[model samples]
Target chain A: MTTGKGAATRLRIVEAAAAEIRERGANATTLDDVGRRSGTGKGQMFHYFPQGREELLLAVAVHEADRVFEGQQPYLDELTSRAAWEAWRDLIVEQYRDQGLYCPLGVLISDVGRYSPASQAVAAQLVRRWQECVRAGIEATQAAGEADPELDADRTAAAVIGAIQGGVTVLLSTGSTEHLEAGLNLCLDRLLL
Target chain B: MTTGKGAATRLRIVEAAAAEIRERGANATTLDDVGRRSGTGKGQMFHYFPQGREELLLAVAVHEADRVFEGQQPYLDELTSRAAWEAWRDLIVEQYRDQGLYCPLGVLISDVGRYSPASQAVAAQLVRRWQECVRAGIEATQAAGEADPELDADRTAAAVIGAIQGGVTVLLSTGSTEHLEAGLNLCLDRLLL
Candidate 1:
């Protein structure tokens, strides 16, 4: 049996909206723009999202949040060896580089203030989950005896996350991945040292 | 003799445009919006910026570049002691926290694709200057024996800057300083260790 056509259309709408939001910012992207980009009629969009632009934005936020983890998966989970670390780093660099300067996660999160509380909660949850994944990686690195015994896993994880964010900001500013490379190298080097 | 009225009006227009861009994003802010926000009439705005919106945007880009350095000044020049480092950290955190989620640098950089070559050049200069300051700080720390002699100043400086950018990105996403704190602590801890 095939999945429901309505669900597929809804997913398509969300994906299209995410793309628009990434290309233009939250404020610049409109429901009409999403409709045009997704090749969906206004009625269909309203049928899927009765609450209008706000609801559709929330959907996009969730989708983008999920993509954040999905895009970094497997690599984000495996930090047991130097090769694995380098692979993860390359994946990260490629992900951002391929996307150019547009940051889907940042765009979604930036509009949280204008979005409903539920939307903000979704963003918060996404961040917490992302941090937890980093925490797990740090714990695994420590367990593998690769990091300092006294290092706080949570703190180290937070720092790694921070470094990636900082590097991404620079990448966005300068359209270069040098900062991202530096961040990943520094964090891994410190861990191994 | 005082500066010419034309020059003064031009400065006012740029300052207002920068504020509007920061409060609202690049795409959301318009020439009309800048005029309204800056208390300049349409004719006056045009008189000062003959090249229209792009000219004004370039001006804002330059102003933002200056602010980035001004914001990190004094401390960015001196990171020889624990107190100095802490002061710099405080300045970094306070700068982002005070600005809330509005990233002027991000706003300018995001629109670089649509800007004049001069604007892009200004942004490039800003990053190089920012990186130089970071490099200077690391060198000072090394000279004072605060950091390991074996550590490469350029790489360490790049890492520190990257971590700060990463932290700032997270801060922008989550609207919290926890990640920023983590990045600063990690960098300092590594140096002290």
Candidate 2:
């Protein structure tokens, strides 16, 4: 839905801000840092985000929220069999491992989600969409006779999402993917059973 | 280990800072705000925390980290049976629900854990201790033959911890406990299976 030179510049600002926040943290990051990283002047930054830091932060929250699922795309969309689930599991492990101790979405939510309803909605929507994808995958697996057809898809999906979220939180703190692997593996085991 | 008037005043500062951060967030919380809330002066704040805000923040991080497991004490300590597990799960749900929208430990880790080794160590230790409790419970359940004996206790515990973390993360964002409930239920189901 985005177009035009202004849209492209806005996207650049958002991306640069997201990266800085990812590295330096939300509280520590300044608009000057974002402007420098994005190669935009104060005038241009204000042009896109007149409400200043809060508006820019909200945009970064939205951007980071989208990336949470977008990064897992194709694999998240493909769930025809037990093998596909396994592959997706591996992808997730690597994804979090590479991202390491800095989880952009988690940081954004913690920084702005509590104080702002709009930011909270972005996080809620992301979680909802993430759970929906997992539920869809479970249904596909059930239809393929690989999973229990009578299983509660919504609960299962919610559990899976929660496990991943928890895993990432631990990973950020401890620099370990063991929890993520365990959570995903256990969720899949339950699904298979 | 704390005693005397000086220790009490230090505790007061840390507690007030934590409460302010919990309500207003870390970035928005100033030392002046903490001093006012705790009825301490700049002299006392600096005397107690010579390195200033970062030192105070690290202390707050440690304080919050300790509280994470302390709140679930006795119950977390007594996860010896299926019944105890269920009780613990309920307690966890109620605890997070009561806390709501503001996870102090999670916020502290996000704010300081990534940049400082001391803060990261505090977070890592908390997660380790948390998983150990869960693993001990799983081991106990297995000993009673209530759970699959061959299940990987460490991994299972990690997954359960992650699920709880994930659930709380979502709950804070959405103001709902569904994900947390789902994560706990699903993990328990797998454990009992």
Candidate 3:
């Protein structure tokens, strides 16, 4: 990481790039647009992203992934009780319901070249972080005797995470939350006592 | 649809486009490449896909979606009993596990502009068809007294479908079948009595 002002400039560039990509798509977005949005000069953009567009895109992808995590705040961290889990699930459903389609997944999958190892790493890390939170919640529920003790927390968390991914992906395609709600409800049914 | 030799030529062009897109990404595959691969002239390509690249891509998206179903043959149709369900689930898992990442979802989401009404219609139709088969299986199992009679087969089917989607999407990111298998198993455990 760069220090002080350099780090801030780099972050500004990344944020600007993310916005440009979101609004105009990666293909349509250019370094000039990002520079204009970020108020960064051509030399500065080159200094930060030495490898140019691809490097800048990776940073934008990371930024988008962070937003996805942040979007599932509060409830995501407090999944100890069944109520909290339900809140988290409903919050997810409502977000997709209201927001139409989630873009981070789309951005990562389409714009970032999901098959590429670098982009996949960003997606994998996000999933791992997400799964870890759910796994901790499962453990907490088990300790409280709210969830079934026989269930494996890690794998089950993986299942629940998968459920959300499938649900959201389907929502993106069908513009409906039935799959998302149903998948979460079923996973919650399995988790809670 | 075109007729006789025209229909054959159109299909040949679509198949060639599908193969070209699969080999080279949508962004990289050109109309010229598709025409050359199909042994069709530029005039013929224009005659078939009057709207050009985007129109051809939509057709390619449908072709890819069809392969996704065909890949899960026989079992997909006969998902009546627990054995069949298990077989179908394993087949899905193994396909991803071996094939690395499923491309049809990628094709729809990335290649065809999943946000557009046209591409999404293809994706929605595939999901609807896929969900219908699973719903039928759930109903059949219920009738045989091997599943819960009170379950809403359609929603449950949606959940199961979501599980598969989540599992596969996660697999694409993390290169692991753990989530896919876990999600499917959890849904199956609830479905099969």
Candidate 4:
């Protein structure tokens, strides 16, 4: 299915909105700003997103969710070896370091009135997908006899996710990656022990 | 050595701004909005904070830092027993649950570009103070012979702070306290182990 030029323009608007939201924040970014950035007029933006800011925000939420997993990539997919875990750790650290404290996912969820059901669903789906990937990695490590076989994979996976989030929060607050490094080290050390 | 009414009004303005920032993110808030909420006219607001929004934001930043330590309170001060740790954990959980995912500290730090140099200094001071409290707790626990005697208190404190942050980030993203609980549990568990 070609999906048409109109669909492409709509996507461009959404992409631009997501970028703006990431750079600034959701509440700070306006539709006019999106239109200007995306090269669409005010009328064209409304034509594509009749529901207006709410619809556009939902789209941005989904886009941000997709990027979360996409950014994690092959490292999130494979964690059977120590080398793989180190690679994944490096990727996680680099992602936050490069972004330097802006958390798009956190920003999207912070606004109480801005979240529609669609946005909530996208956020939930993203978490579940991310958790599942971690779970799979834990299972792979267990199967490879690298991690404790008796350790509950689900719990460990949750802990890993929790640690990363905690570390990121600290990074966001202080503009430093030291806390993030500590969290990652603790999780990996626990696994090795 | 009595402070003038001007100083008192300035204090009130800062308090109101901090509350508003806590409820709605820094970017979503405006000087007019803050003045309205604080029951101050533009003239009065400017009279107190001549530099305008940036000065007010810096004031709010300092207020938030105080709140961070104040919220951690007697619990953060007392970590001599296992029971004390549990109480501290409960306090931490309730703090986040009641705050409801809006991290005032994170919000203030996120908009650093819009804040004055004093605001940045306040934030840095807050984190250092927080780390010191954690370090104190670690030292107390070690003195009680609860943790490894030879363990580096600073590093352990850093790890604990990191774990809590990583966990809180997950809680903010998922809207569940489970991750926060897990992170706290893992840290305490490892500390005892």
- Scored by DockQ, the top model is 3
Model 4 chain B scores worst on lDDT over the 10 consecutive residues at B107-116
* Predicted model with the maximum TM-score: 3
Worst 10 residues of 2 chain A by lDDT: A99-108
Ranking by lDDT: 3, 2, 1, 4
TM-score of 1: 0.87
TM-score of chain A of 2: 0.90
| DockQ of every candidate structure | 0.55, 0.75, 0.76, 0.47
| Residue pairs that clash (backbone atoms under 3 angstroms), model 1 | A165-B166, A166-B165, A166-B166
Candidate 2: tens digits of C-alpha lDDT, residues B3-50: 698899999999999999888778788999999999999999999999
Worst 10 residues of 2 chain B by lDDT: B100-109
lDDT of 4 at A190: 67
lDDT of 1 at B135: 78
> What is the lDDT of every predicted structure here?
0.75, 0.83, 0.84, 0.73
lDDT of 3 at B75: 91
What's the iRMSD of model 2? 1.3
TM-score per candidate, chains pooled: 0.87, 0.89, 0.94, 0.86
Model 1: residue B117 alpha-carbon error in angstroms: 5.5
Which residue segments of model 4 deviate by more than 4 Å?
Answer: A1-7, A41-44, A110-118, B1-7, B22-25, B36-44, B110-120, B149-151
Fnat of candidate 2 is 0.87
lDDT of 2: 0.83
Docking class of 1: medium
Report the lDDT of model 1 for residue B59. Answer: 73
Please, what are the lDDT tens digits per residue for candidate 2 over residues A27-86?
A: 778999999999999999999998888789888877876776788878898876888999
Specify the CAPRI tier of model 2: medium
Sequence-dependent TM-score of model 2: 0.89
Candidate 4 on A1-193: residue-level lDDT in tens? 4269988998899999988877777768899899999999999998888989978887777777677778878888988877898899998899888855555556545542422455556555666677789888888888988877776777777777777776776666666677777767666766753
